[model samples]
Target: MNDKNSTEPTQPQPPKNNVKGAWNQVCGWMQENLFWTVAYVIALLTTVLVGRELFEGDHSATFREWVLFFLATILFFGAVRFVQIFTSCIREDTQKPGQEGESKEHEILKAKELQKIELQKRSWLIFSYSFMLFALFAALLPFVFDVEQRSAAELSKRPIAVFVGCVDYSTDDEAHSREELRCQLVDSAQSPAPGTQAPKPITSLTQQTSETTPKPGEAKTSDTTDTTKTEYAVITNTTKTMPTDTGIKTEVTREITFHRYSKNGMWIINIGGMVNRCNTDIYCVRGGLSVPLYFVILALFGGAISLTRRIPEYQKQAYPKYIQIDEKRPKLQPNQLREYLVFQIVQFISAPFIAVVAYYLVVPESTVVSVTLGFAAGFASETILLMIRAVMDKLNPSTTRSTQFGSISGYIEHNGQPVKDANIRVIGQQGLEAKSDDSGAFVINSVPPGEHVLEIKHTTGTQSKDVRVNSGQATSCHIKL
Candidate 1:
């Protein structure tokens, strides 16, 4: 019986290659990147549409609506991806102590790790360039389409019309009284008649003013005619008409129009007792102004193309496919910082363009459509490319793979309670071992995929159990001591 048990070989789980297996894999992939993929498709369509609209005149409001719909979708996905990135960055800041260890592994595994890092750097570099190219394309779009010319012509035809209406008014009597007082004040301020004396101060409402002393060379005047000017147009009282058997009142209405034009950049017009001043020009519109939008688009394209292809000259120094360095770090020492910069620069270049594109798709005549489209393309292209790259990476399997490793993790308990700080040992594999955490959880990583005996030891007692670990799978086991 012992011989039979020792000689037996554990069969590995078959590769998931059936219809169901393919479906599951596809579903899983979609679950991870479906939103991003959809966004990519929409962005591509918008780009094509915008390009078409620039060269052709057949695009209508419906096309703009479709573009807007896609843009909104992209924005939603971008927001979600941004959140995920932020959370992941936060999580990465806190290091997991259990995962780090000094490995006496062979050179080939180390080489593979280096290759993976290199591949990641290349991927990001390519993504950054793609972003910059898209941005450049957006910035130059208006210029290419001669949108400024169209806007100038449109402005000429429209000539900017403004309208105003009375919102409220004071009681009629109150308004008339205020106007009368204003007129009296204006009359009092008028200059005295030439060669006439300044008027003397009045004492009472019925009293006449005394004569003023004239200058030595000028004649004096009694001015008993009441020199103070009178406002004959002032309404002193409100009159009420006789009411009929049925309650009714008469109303009067009038319409007035004024035409005005700007001279030397100044314009003044009155409408509904409100004065408006406006200065208009083509330069006031951002789209009409001469800006190097094309330069931006070119930069994006150049950056995207240059960074994407791995230059043979830089590979050995910048990122080595295999590192002989004794340090645990993968790739060149400076690669991480460069990688981080690439990511940040790509994001910065793409953000504005993304917004512009989204806006343009919805508003066909929008001034910043180019910038928006550029931003949308730049922002989302990275995520789209990442999905493709990930799929490709999985498809291209390494022929030199060593015996694959899997992991086993479980809880150690005592009378249904967690046994904290328990020791876990795997028979025959010195590399496979772990210690239970405060939650009585233990994980033995990089275990050979096969049947293994797990020994759990605590201060109180010990327990043993058999566990089967499949390649690339996490096997769970529970042990009671």
Candidate 2:
């Protein structure tokens, strides 16, 4: 029987977390959270590509549709994730008030746990509000500033305009009268630069002289014929060239412009559908903030999103829990929370600047799509990262199951002597009560790690001690009264 027992194999334990160097820790973290790492990498790549595309002013409507649809998909995921977390919090809250037949000590512990859960839920609610605000900002960033003011007639024909200039040149010899017409399609802001007529056409005429000798065995010609064609044709899809002693050059220049809409010019030539370019306005819109309206709109969106999540009836009917939670999840540490908050604040502050830079890169040409898409990408990236961190924390088994709870232990003494019947309690944590033994030794179980206030009450008086706790580790403190 001893041999049989010795031969039996024990179950394998989960891997223990070891202290590692910064690089090693990063590697280990990436290895453990490979899914989230891949997701973040993909999001970064997508954001970069989208930003570049926006900056360059990609004109493909299909690409724009694709980006918008991707943002919509991200919103859907964010909403679902928010609903899941919100439902989890609600379930915990609903379960807390229903615990019955428990002793006073156990009830206190339960109540303390519930209070902690409530704090966490409120934090998450604030996080959701932040996300909603970001989304609102992204959605309205293009229209925050008013467009450049223009006359009704200019606005009516603003998409396409023709600046026509006609010049007549007189020459000697045969009294040649050459008529030259210059037509151009310029931006509304770029038109005629205030009180000025169409741009003066820079015209230059060159004369080429050549002499031809007769072929071999033939007589030389005394007179040279000038066979130059002075009449030039201006056609949309045609080219005319003039040959000179220097080289053959095109006489008429044609530029095909791409715009938001096709345009037909009734002038010397038509410069079809050109870019909806901006000039002085920079954004194609006037630069000035309508701060009140913009903030009010964002507030409305945030309030609506908050109310929808907070109302229990709405949560139950609309955002019902689809996934079941079989076990408790790991709670975030204060340090981890600080890191999260810093990261999110950075993202939020940089989001609009990124969009603005992208817009400026494609200035003189409207970058509305780019700014909106870039903003959306930033918002989505932040929201997705938040969701990933929350989900990863929940799925981390070691922190969730083995170290989900902690304990606190210490001694109560006065004048180097044991103080029996000294009651110790964790402030903000009910049911976490302990009485010192004859040796002044006390122990409290089911206490969470991190900062906590410990209050000791005895015949002497009541005193509070601030303490820090670590997961699965015993924290010792001595109180003197």
Candidate 3:
């Protein structure tokens, strides 16, 4: 009977298959959470419309018009929420289990639910991200398009021209006293009298002495006479006096010049002018790649996080032990290690190249290179985390892998509760294992299908046991470590 039992082939267990049902469950959850989707859509549409009007509408619109526009937007959003709630409730009723061809119906319902959920989620997210992007664009718009004005004052001072001729006069006492005696005769002629002729011009003493010339045969005497004459005259003069203390104070104003293109429903405002000023004040309205690039970068990081979650290491799984063991096995050859190291070096060096490209092609001119460098550094940190996880798994088989070279089972404990992240190994064999998750239970799936001698090594000590494995079937044993 024992030989027959051993000879009979055991049935291969069916592969676990519940993924479709799990997807349906997720879809159902999203269908029930429609409020977030509706709110997001309403907010996004309102922002876009209002932002457009603000940019393009006539400047003549009053504050009251703006208030009314905002109020109407609020009412529209509220109405959308009401409709969303009603439709969502109807969807929930249709999703209940047990109807004709129930499984098929469930699948169909699930598909519809998933579609609605995805539409709402994506629409809302796009709206939100786009609104933020537009707001940033608008805020920076004014800086690019406006012109500046400048003013200045100036003053100058200098001396005016006087006369450019010489004056004649005498200060000698003999000349002045002799001229005074002649002046008395002139004064007598100037006295008021009937039939007074103009006074004869006074002649110098030298002229008077020379007036009598020597006649023919008259005795000639050698005599020389020298006399100087002084002239008195009154001169009119004008003088300019400057203030004792004076200073110049200058005031300057500056403005910038630029152009802007604005749009409203059907109206377009193209304002192009120069702002002039004397001082240093700069104003510019710029529209370029930076704002959009920022949003794109943000989306990229979010996508990275989502991608990380998709990896088996991070995803939730029922039998994580088997997966961890498979991942940690010594599969890489020595050459592969060299390749990996080379890859790491290449990745580390490529960051600067990527930043240079982004600065020139993706980032705006106003953005500093330092900001680009910082972004690159943050990306490098994430890459390092991935590398560390891979490297540690390669180096420590006992700590990181799960396999059954020799079978032994144990319960992990910490302060009387089960401890996770604990290491357990079989002595004198390349047999190593670890617990899965926060639960201290583990199973090693790599051992040969047969009874075997096993030793359990823990942090404190080691214990021995005998275990058996059936082909394709797991054998269970329990111990405290």
Best by lDDT: 2
The TM-scores of all predictions, comma-separated, are 0.28, 0.26, 0.21
Best-fitting candidate, scored by TM-score: 1
What is candidate 2's CA lDDT for residue 292?
Answer: 14
Model 1 C-alpha lDDT versus the unseen true structure? 0.45
lDDT of 2: 0.46
lDDT (C-alpha) at residue 243 in model 2: 47
lDDT of 1 at 479: 77
Model 3 collision count: 21
Clashes found in each candidate (C-alpha, N, C closer than 3 A): 19, 8, 21
> Per-residue lDDT for 1-481 in model 1, tens only?
3775576777998786699988998778778977666765666676666655554655455554554455454445444444433323211111112224546564455656656655655554454444445444444543443222222223334433122111111345332221111111112234568998644322112211222223233222211121321121111222222233333222222111111112122111112232221112111211111122432353355334433332322344345334435323323333343444445555555643443333223332333554444433444556534644676787896678777888998988776889898978886687678899989998989988988877665667545577898988999987777
Off by over 4 Å in 3: 1-102, 132-136, 139-143, 147-481
Q: Model 2: clashing residue pairs? A: 108-430, 108-431, 109-431, 258-274, 258-275, 259-273, 259-274, 278-364
- The superposed Cα distance between candidate 1 and the true structure at residue 377, in angstroms, equals 21
The lDDT values for all models are: 0.45, 0.46, 0.37
Pairwise TM-score winner, candidates 2 and 3: 2
